[model samples]
Target: MWWFWTLWAVVALTHCSAMDRNKDKALKLMKQTPLIDGHNDLPWQIRKQFNNQLSKVDLNTIQTTHTNIPKIKEGHLAAQFWSAYVPCDTQHKDAVRQTLDQIDIIHRMCDAYPESFMFATSSQDIMEAFIQNKTASLIGVEGGHSIDSSLGILRIMYRLGVRYLTLTHSCNTPWVDNWKVDTGTEAPVHNGLSPFGKQVIKEMNRLGMLIDLAHVSEKVMNQVLDLSKAPVIFSHSSAYSLCQHKRNVPDAVLKRVRDKAGIVMVNFYNDYVTCSQTANLSQVADHFDHIKKVAGHTVIGFGSDYDGVRRVPKGLEDVSKFPDLVAELLRRGWNDTEVRGALGENLLRVLKDVERVRDSLTKDQPDDVPIPYEQVENACRTNYGYFPLDNTGHSASQSPLVLALATLLCWFFGGSSYSCRP
Candidate 1:
C-alpha cells in the first residue's frame, strides 16, 4: 500500500508539473499578444441575476456564473466582445430598448472597473488595451431582432460601438431566418434573407460591423457568404459535423467561410461542443480543431458563451479555463503562429478588413432599404407610419388629413410646408 501511494504521488506530481509548464507557456504568449474572445453574455447575466446593478454585484468576487474579474484576469483575455443579447420575446416589442440597455450595462461594467476594462471599437483599440493591460470590452448584438428590421436602428447601434450583429437568434426576424429553419422546428420566414436582410448585410459592411452568422439558418449562412463583401464570423458557434446542432456551422459553410476570409469562433457550451449536456475540455478543443481543419487555423477563434449557458464543458468550466484550451492546442502540435492567430490576431485582422471596406464605401450613400409591408404585416406588427415614399422618394402622402396638417404648417411657417419636394 505504501509503495502504491508513493507511485500515485509521483504520477500526480508529474502531471501537475506538466500542467504548470503548459500554463506558463500559454500565459507568456497571451501576454505578448491580445487574446480576444468573440462572444460573452455577461451583460445578459448581470441583467437577469443582478437586476443590472453593478453596485450590488461584485465583478471581483467569484460568483456561480462563469465570468468575474478574477476569472477574466486568470483567463488572460485581452479583448472580449460582450454580447448585448436581447431576448426573442423582445423581438417586435422592445428589442431595441433592451439591446440599448444591455449596451449601457456593458459600458457601465467597464466604467465600474476602469483599471481592468475599457471600451474598444476597433483593432487598434484592442492593441492599445493589450499594451495597457486592460480588457478591451467590445460590443456585439446577439440577434438582428435587436435592430427590429430597421437599417436606421442598426446604424445607430454601430455608432454606439457595437462591432458585430448576429443576424438571428432562436427566433427569426422579419427579414431573416434563424437556426430553426435547419432544425425543422420552425419554417423560415425569409427563406434565406429577404431583400431587406440583404440590405442589412450591405449596411453592416458600410458600417464596418463584423457580420456574425452564429444563429442564422444554413441558407442564411450561405446567402451571407455570397453577399457580404466583408469578412464574417460565427461569434459563438461550433462545428456542425461534430455536434449535429443547427446552431453549429456545417463543414461546407466552414470551408466557404475560409474562402471568404471569415472566422468561426468556437462555442464552449457543453451541448454545442458535444451535443450532450455533459462534456469535457477535450471535447471543446475538438470543436476548435475540427473548425480549424475545415476553415483553417486563421479562421478559428474562441467564443466561450460564458454566463449564457448553464452546462459548460468540464475542463473549460469558467472564463479562466481559456489557457487550458490553448495548452491543449499546443499539446496537439499547434505552432506558435497558429496559436497566436487563434488567440486574437485573426479576429483583429478581420476587424481591420471590415473597417477598410467601410472606408472604401465612404462616399457611398446609405441604402435605406425598408422591409415591404406585406412581408411583415401581422398581428405582431403595427402600421403607425404615414408618408410612405414612392420611387421618386418625395414627400409621398397627400391624404386629406396630411393635407390639412400641411395647410396648417404652411399657414404657420410661411407656406414652405406646401412644397412636395421634401
Candidate 2:
C-alpha cells in the first residue's frame, strides 16, 4: 500500500512538472519564430482615442488600451498587420479619404517609434524587422469602400504599402454584399459578386494585395476563391459552425480555402469565437480546433482583432496575453511546428504566394480601366440573373476571369504595349 501511494504521488508531480516545462517551451518558441498577427486595429483605436494624435497616447508605456509597445514586446509579437478600418457609416468618398488618413497614421506610428517599430511590406521585410529587434508593421485597409469603386485608388493603396484589403465592412459595397448587412435582408443586390467585383479580385492578384474575406457574404467568399489565382485570407474571423455568427466562416468555405491553399486567421473576439456573452481562452482554442479540423493546420493563423472589439477572450484580454494562448495550445498537445504555423508561418506563406502571383502578372497590362457607369448599373440590375459559379450564361467574352487570363496570355506572348499603371 505504501509503495502504491508513493508511485501515484510521483506520477502526479511528473505531470505537473511537464506542464510547466511545456509552458516555458511555448514562450521560447514564440521568441524564436515571432508571431505575425494577421490583424490588429490599433490604428483605428488611435484614431478614435486620440484623434490620430500620437502625442496623446504613449505607446511606450502601458495605457488603458489593449496594446502598447511594452505589452506587445511581452507578448513576443514579431509582426502585426495593423488595420486601417473606416466605419461603414462613412460615406464613399469620405471613407476613402479616411482610410488614407488611417494608413498615414499607421506609418506615423511606426516612424514615431523607430527602435520599436518598422514598416514591412514583404515577408523578407518582416524577417529583417524581427532580426533587428523591431516589430514589423504592415497596413491592411479594412473595407472595399475605401477604394470607392476605383481600381486606380486600389493600386495607389498597394503602392503606399497597404498589403491587404478586406472586401467589405459591416455594410454592402456597390459591388459586394456584406455578411452582416445582407443577412436576413431582401435578396442581396448582387447575388454573390458583380462583374466589377470579380475584376477587383483579379486586380488584387495582379497587384499582390491579399484579398481578405472577413466581412463578405459566403457567396462572395466562394466566388473569390474560384476566381483568385493567388491565396486569399480571412484577416479576422472565426468558425461559423462553432459560433453561428454571420461574420464567421462556414465549414464549406473553410474547405474551399484549404483547396485554394489559402489561410484563415482566427479572430479573438469573444462573441465571434464562442457565440456567447461570456467567453475565455479555452473558447478561443475551440475555434482553432474546428478550423483545423476543417482546413488543416497549414491553413490556420492568428488575427486577434485587438483594439477592434470591446470584449476579448478572458485569458486573452490584451496583446500581452498572446503567450497565454500559445501556452494553452501547447498544453492541449499541439507540437512546436503546428503552433508556429498558427503563429505566423501560414500567413507568411500566403504573402509569398500573393507575391508570386503578382510577379507572374508583371508583364500583363495593368487593369486601370474602370467599369463604365452604364455597365456597372447593368450588372447591378442583373444581380440575381446568373450563378456566380457558372457564369457561362453571361457572354464568355465579357467574363472578367477570362479577360484577365487572356491578358496574362497576351503578356506572355509580348503582345501588350498598353500600360494601365497608376
Superposed on all Cα atoms, the candidates' RMSDs to the truth, in angstroms, are 7.2, 11.5
Q: Show model 1 residue runs off by greater than 4 Å.
A: 1-15, 378-422
Q: In model 2, state the lDDT of residue 227.
A: 96
For candidate 1, the 10 contiguous residues with the lowest summed lDDT are 413-422
lDDT of 2 by residue, 1-422 (tens): 99999999999999989778877988899888869898898888888888998887889874867899999888899999999998876633367778898999999999899999999999999999989989999999999988877898999999999999999988778788888654686358788788889989999999999999999988899899999999999999999999999999999999999999899989999889878778899889988888888889999999999999988878898888888888888888888899999988999999999999999999987786665555434211222332343455654335667556655754555445322111
Error of 1 at 90 (Å): 0.9
Please give the lDDT score at residue 420 for candidate 2. 19
- TM-scores, all candidates, are 0.89, 0.85
* Per-candidate total of colliding backbone pairs: 0, 0
Best by TM-score: 1
Total colliding residue pairs, candidate 1: 0
Q: Write the per-residue lDDT of candidate 1 for residues 303-324, one digit (tens) a residue.
A: 8888889899888888898999
